[model samples]
Target: MIPLRLKIETDAIEPYVVRLRSFEGISDESHHTGALDAALESASAETAEFSGATGNLRLFGVDPSEVNGDVLFVVPSRGTAHRLIRANSRHNTLLVTERCDQLCLMCSQPPKKQHIDMFPFFETALLLSQKNSTIGISGGEPTLFKSELFDFFNRAMSRRPDIDFHVLTNAQHFDRADLPILRRLDLTRILWGVPVYSSDSDVHDRIVAKPGAYDQVRRSLSLLCEAGAKIELRTVLMKPNAPGLLDLAKFVTTALPFVDSWAIMQLENIGYARQNWDTLFFDSSTGFDIVGKALDFAISRGIDTKLYNFPLCTVPTDYRAFAPSTISDWKRAYVADCADCSLRNECGGFFEWHPKVHGYERFGVA
Candidate 1:
């Protein structure tokens, strides 16, 4: 589901639908070409002079690099176009690294050993992101580049003082030394989306394929709480964790009560997850009652809870409101039965990689 349109706007700039055209595809009347340098070199009377560059090209208030690819859009005012720098169809998540220490069975963006430094790209991305829009920081594990990560956060905070940050980390790398750095940042809106797979340390450790990951994350959570940092603990629901979901909820309510929110999410069938479907996939439709019970218990205890990536048809009516449209639009899809579903507009549907072999038997109109 590649989004056909992207809305780009700034504080004073009216929104514009990002128009794309290749260098060869552009008409003589079109405003842009492949490189910003090329646009400058080949200025003509009919077309608006515009050039495209992946990361460094700066024009019309935006670094074309932040746009990711060739883009054609005009701004009524100068400097206002910078707001579109981090604009993309999916939520604005600046992927900081592909390296990770833990290996979860259902990891979507699995860890890579290759030398891929995203700090520079992220620096430009953070600078270009909208000041008011929530910017997400993600990775195979963001803390791999701790100094660069904290530096980027502080810079982003100063540049876009009003924007909030949502960072997805395993929360295993947080050490006592990192506490002072976290305190330095304006953390009111910096949310750490940490994953805690199970109540048992052994189970949690096994899920992440790390012997002491559970203890590490537990320590990190305590450090974050002590620093007054906002935390959103996430659990990716699957066969291994489903039976213990209620226990995990209880653990959160009792041991980790300082967490701002709890997200029990459906597994996204992609990357390593696709290969491990037989082992990891669980039909939520058949066991929604258990899921609901876990959620109900958490909510009853006044812990903010949310259902991520669960389809409306598969969730109980009582828990429907907690289920947000969680999948990125580019990777989201709907089956034939979704055509007549009452909540189709609000549903997150399934991941594009979810094959029919693993689909739910109870899929239909809600």
Candidate 2:
């Protein structure tokens, strides 16, 4: 048996077993806690042939068996920090709905339930809003259930007008109907965050898995801005869209001047991710190209820009400014790649799925 070395990411909430070798080894079937040694033993050996160098290895078993070694790691972000702060965070996510006209390739939740009564969600959000200055409402698509959507929005804002509510939408439905309620909501207080995968209509439509989605999103954005509603445009980078990434940001900077800001998120590894992993995900090494270009483009236009899920790559070498933001650290993909990184503390690390699929060991110096 090849003695397998195990690597673990510590950023995880619950400790997990890291097994780099195959399960076929050793003796006592019942006595063994699977392949993991209850107590980690220690050793050192060359890890990657590419580096032609050795890394210290910690063993967690009494038996000295030979097996493949695996590396596991974790890095926390603002989102993880916030979840840690609140005791009831387990009850705190806003699953606005399971309904959405566009089928984004990365839709975290599908059109599972379609519509939801705002009361159920509002009952919970109202309590959190008291303590949180900003409450972000994410969904199968928040705009789908307009009345219930605004119903909760109204209740929260009414109770604490000082609190800011943010709603993420595909921006498909809000435009066509000329409802007074949609316009009545104070744009000054609410933030309507929109998702645009690409600028090209054809690219955007296919990626969304819905035709004509580009037109609707385009029109809704125009209407939302015209009605004086605050706007935030977001883009999630993927393999297919990597090349034209900066163009999307360029379009928003030129056309949607009303958008309060722009944010570029690296694709996470989860849900529909594995099915599309070969095409949807990009490693952090390849990612710096896309991020560096987009950041420069948005900054040239004087728009506030950000990169979530990766601060190790995004931090400025000379000086920096900090803004509060929440991001998912891919527990499934986060890599221990940033080991010995200069900006590890400030960096949120990659999505778990990212490192799981791409391997954190490959992530290296620029």
Candidate 3:
């Protein structure tokens, strides 16, 4: 696993985004004012010195090679730095806010009443992102602050049109009122990942711990489709909604055919999920009949369907091709039994926190 935040000692007082510069010349100097020179040749891997207009700073307890050329958000008061854009990483995500209205049963990032607005810093970080990179915008729910979020998108995309964004939202906030602004944006460059658990309203609402969420999500999705927006319908598979997977697939193909793709995902063992594991964790390793049937049904209807965060071995051979390595590198991991597996490179393995004792029952070479 890779660390996202590292401790640093800097003299600067304000928050600023700076791209680390190695011995080589900077690639795109127009995005930022000055580069923080990263002394990668130093003998110690634990700490390295970085200097810029702000002053010299030491990044302690980290390998210099891992962060060289990465864009970092330095906060002097916290004495910590976040890698907003990694030079070597293909996956980059910016967490917009932590406040959400819905309290889902398996929310990986649990909601908090307090939210610190990071739109300004995120906009600057987006400008410093790598060329033609697809960045992910995730949160408790990004649409909570719809106005500022829209403004951030407009400003960031206007300056960096080459970058594409995949924003994760609950799809409960959008209404007909947001059509004008939504239509004006470049819909082709943005893909909204909206979650729809089940076709049954009672089941969907029960899973999210919100009343009438199913109807609201359907309405919001219709609005998005009318606005010519690209969307990726996301459904996290769990025990509560596992049986209705096929029904949801049928509903998606019949009622929401405009969705660009449908992604069925596994639950991560964190946040609220950790507390509800016994009831929510569905072991698809041995019981993949329902999931496979749903994928087949969606694919037969000409809808692009995929399985996210599922290890290749858990899926049957016929459906293995549909499961890509979708886990982000930072939290993706493998077990000792997988060391000798022939498909380790092609498999997503598991989440770093996936329970080794009571997790997948069937584990072997594919």
| Superior by lDDT: candidate 1 or candidate 3 | 3
lDDT per residue as tens, model 3, 245-329: 9999999999999999999999999999999999998989987999999999999998999999998878888898999999989
Give me the runs in candidate 2 sitting further than 4 Å from their true place: 1-92, 114-121, 176-179, 311-325, 328-340, 355-366
Residue-by-residue lDDT tens digits, candidate 1, 1-366: 553223332333432323233244445786544322224323233322333342222233333333343223334354333222324554656667788999899999988987566555455445444447787788888898889889988876787787788999998788999888989988897999999999988888988999989988999999999999999999999898899999999999999999999999988888888899888988898888778889999999999999999989988787789999989776889988789888999999888878876467666789
Residue-level lDDT of model 2, residues 1-366, one tens digit each, is 122123322333532222223233444453332233222333335321111012222333323233332222211221111121122221224556676676678765556644645455344335433354555677777777776777676666777777676778888887546446667766688888888888888888888898888999999998887788888888887777777888887887898877888877766666676567677865545455666777788878988877665444444443123222245321322246567666555566655434344533344432
What clash count does candidate 1 reach? 5
TM-score of each: 0.80, 0.67, 0.95
Q: Which one is best on TM-score?
A: 3
RMSD of each: 8.4, 14.8, 2.5
Candidate 2 residue 122 Cα shift, in angstroms, is: 1.8
Question: Distance from true position, residue 46, model 3, in Å?
Answer: 2.6
Error of 3 at 327 (Å): 0.6
lDDT values, one for every candidate: 0.74, 0.57, 0.87
Query: What are the runs in model 3 whose C-alpha is more than 4 Å off?
Result: 24-43
Q: Give the TM-score (vs. native) of candidate 3.
A: 0.95
Q: Name model 1 segments beyond 4 Å from true.
A: 3-90
